[model samples]
Structures are given as C-alpha cells and as structure tokens.
Target: MQANSLDDLAAGLARNRIAGLVADLRLDGLHSKAEAAAVQTAALDAYADDFAGYVLVGTSELSRRGLGLSSPIFAPLADRALFGDGWRIHLPQGMIGAQCELAFTLGRAYPERGESIDRHSAADAILACQPAIGLLGRRVRPGTESELAAIADFALHVATVCGPLVEPADKDSLDRAVMTARIDGKTVVTAKAGTILGHPLEALVWLAQKLARHNRQLNAGDVVTIGSCAPILQVLPGQHLTVEFEMIGTASCWFD
Candidate 1:
C-alpha cells in the first residue's frame, strides 16, 4: 500500500519523474487498485506542477484495477508532451486519425473552483490558434469488452500539431462552422466544430474544469486541442494532409 495519495503521484508525473516509476511498473506487469490510485495521484500532482491536470482516466485502467492485477501498464499520457511544449511520438499501427477542430491558446490560468469564467472570458485569453490533433492509438489486439489487458500499449501519442494564431470569437454557432481535411488534394473528412462537444467552446470548458480537478489549470499560452471533429483517417507513407477550420485557421502535416 502506498502511503502517498493520487495527488502526490500526479505531482511527481507532472515533474517528469514518474516516467522512471511508470517504466518500472510496466516491466513488472503489476496492477493493483493501490497502484492505480498512486499513479492517478502522481498524475494529479504532476498536473499541479504544470497547473494543467488530467481528470479522466482511460477506461482500460479502471477495468484492469477492478480485476485485481498488480502494476497494470498506463496509457502514454498526452499531458507529458503538452507540458514540455514539445515532444513527438510515432503513430502506432491501427492508429490513424485526421481530425479538424479549433485549437485554444489560453489567456490566463484557468481557475478550478473560483468564479467560473464564461466563454467570452475565454475568448480574450487567446494567445495563438492553430488546428490541433489528439493522436490516439488503441491497445494492441483489443480484448472482448472486459478481457482487456493494459493501457500502457496504447500510450503511443503520435503528435500534437497546432498553428500560429487565429481570431477568437464567442462562437455560439460553432456547429454551423464547417471544417475539412484534405489528403493529397483529395477531401478526406469534413465536419463542424460542434462535433467536438456540441460546441467547440464546450471543449474549452471541459478542459478547464477537468484540469481543475487535478489541481491544474490552463494558463495563458497553453494550447488546448478541444477534441476531434471528424473520424480517424488512416494514412500512408508520404501522405500530405491539410486541415482547415472555420474561424480558427489551418495546419498541415506529412506522414512518413
């Protein structure tokens, strides 16, 4: 049993020290509720360090601990790269998604439980805007519903790409705003900002609140990828993809 709490673990991870510990757990293939709590705590602490925390745990982690395993592997957390303001990962097999959505550059440290800030309050805090991607990969050889193994395998976060700057607006009719992704000049996926969470700003709100729970806040100059607007698009080597949004702007990438 770990004497430390989830908050402690979160802080450790936020500081990048948890990587070694996470590696050790992965090597041992141990999974226990105590360990999971410790990891979550470490994650929360890590978020506190950066002032940007993750409130949600992937579903796989929850189920594994429920089954009483020791040291289950963890998903490659996205916050790590986000905290560094720069990092890259190779996309895993069966993991390809080209999403179009608004990317938020915050204006201030989004408070967790203080006076809640409205959508307009968020608009003024914008630093830069670029289309963003979450880069998700599934567990290798996914099990049938409950027989899932580990989330550590799914920890391969490809990349998070954001552009320079774009205009910030109230964005009430985000769903009406159309965004598209093109590959090699061919349209691949098209959707609206509303696809993110009814409204793009909602993603901002979700991000703000979620971060707060982990004792982290989105401060000014943090780039927040709201979520995906389109379905995952498989890519091949040398594929050129361009994503265009409504009021936000555009970003491009080349797959090797």
Candidate 2:
C-alpha cells in the first residue's frame, strides 16, 4: 500500500495533474516526511520514465509542491536535501509570503545522462543566474528542513519569476545592495540580496549539487530561486506589487 501510494503520487507529478490535487491535500491535512519523499521520488521516476521533454520542469515539480508540505517532512530531509535559496509555503485563505533570491540555470548537461546528478558537478556547472521571487501561501505550515519533502510535494511553489542575470558577485559585497518591494507604490519589504544563505550565489551553487543526489541537474534556461533575503510579507487581491534592485533592476505583478 505504501509503495503503491508513493507510485501514484509520483505518477501524478509526472502528469502535472497533481498541482491542484496537492493544493487540495495540503489544505485538508498534512503527510509524513517519508510519505512525502516517496511521493517526490515517484514523481521524479515517472518524470524520467515518461516525460523526457520537460525533464527540468518535471524534476523541479517536487520542489514546487514541497513548499506546502507540513513540518514533519522538513525535519528529516534537511540534512539530505539540497535546498534552493528561495521557497514559500502558502497558508490557507490567501495570506502570502514572498521569498526573493538569486537562482541558477545550467548551460551544460550536468551529472550526465541516464544517471542522477552528483553533488560535486551539480555545484560546479552554474552557467547563468537570475533574480527571482517565490510566492508562499502564508496559511500553510510545511514544517522545517523538508526541502526534499517539499520538492517531492512540489515545494508548494505557486509561481516563480526571474529578472535579468548578472555576473556572479562576491558574497560579502552582494549584501550591501538594496532590494525593495512596493505594493501599490507602498513599501512592503526591503533588504539586501544576501538575506539568503548569506550569499545568494552560494545558495544557487549549493542547490545544484544538492539536487544531483536525486538524479536532477540544473538545465540551461532552468529558473532556480536561491533563497529569500527579505522577510515574507502580506499581500492581497487587487493589489499591484513591484520590486527593484540597485543593480539587477525591477519586476512587478498584480494579485487577483
């Protein structure tokens, strides 16, 4: 029963039909980390087994859903899972937490074909990096350290958007740059890009290597969010949100 349930979860992810279902499940209750991991592994296996065209998207689907998994999942996977810098778990009813960070995309096929990515090469082949925001549903509590569980569950990652890429910056110097967000021209949250794992670039590099263990790699054009440097703030419907970076530029979105 356990294995079959795991396979079913994986198959759902492979089909990309699990998003709404996951959203539904998370809203209703939470699952154990082992169960969530089984779901993620199944999804990855199904993704590799069936949909080869969207390997990167299929692989990250777990990360996308995992964001919403309960805290039980995070406790076990924290040590084993490679965490992307930024991720958000949405709470029930529309309270949102926005996680902003830098992400990576691989220009070369990493960890090779037919095999999952390994930690070392996964960390090495970061071709391009971009600034991004991860929208978290504030109503949900997916637990702590469950990056793998969250990835397996889709990270509860609702949407991910990226700005233009800049050359990698040194860790110590990156923090001084200012980052600000305004909702309807009103400031919501502001901080330095270094809020994530200290230096956002290192987080990206770290994520690449971490994802390798599950046979995943950062692909060219794959959008990765390193971590949030700023605190997750409240957002609402019919509101327009904008963010600007001293060097990286700006992006905005409206909530319905």
Instruction: Identify the runs in model 1 with alpha carbons over 4 angstroms from their true place.
Output: 1-96, 138-141, 144-156
Error (Å) of candidate 2 at residue 128 is 3.8
Per residue, candidate 1 scores C-alpha lDDT tens digits across 1-256 of 3344434434533333323222212212225534544554444444434423222112222222433323222232344444221223344444535444456666666753464756655555555556755454332233311212222222223345555566655456555777788888899878776655556666666656655666766766566665566665666657776777777666766666
- Compared with the true structure, model 2 gives a TM-score of 0.61
Please give the range of 10 consecutive residues that has the lowest summed lDDT in model 1: 54-63
- The sequence of per-residue lDDT tens digits that candidate 2 reaches over residues 1-256 is 3566567556755454223232222311225545665665555555433221111111222233433322211111111112222222222342345555555566566545654434345445556555665554321233432444444544434455556666544433655668888878988777876654445545544555555666666456454555556655566766666667776666565656
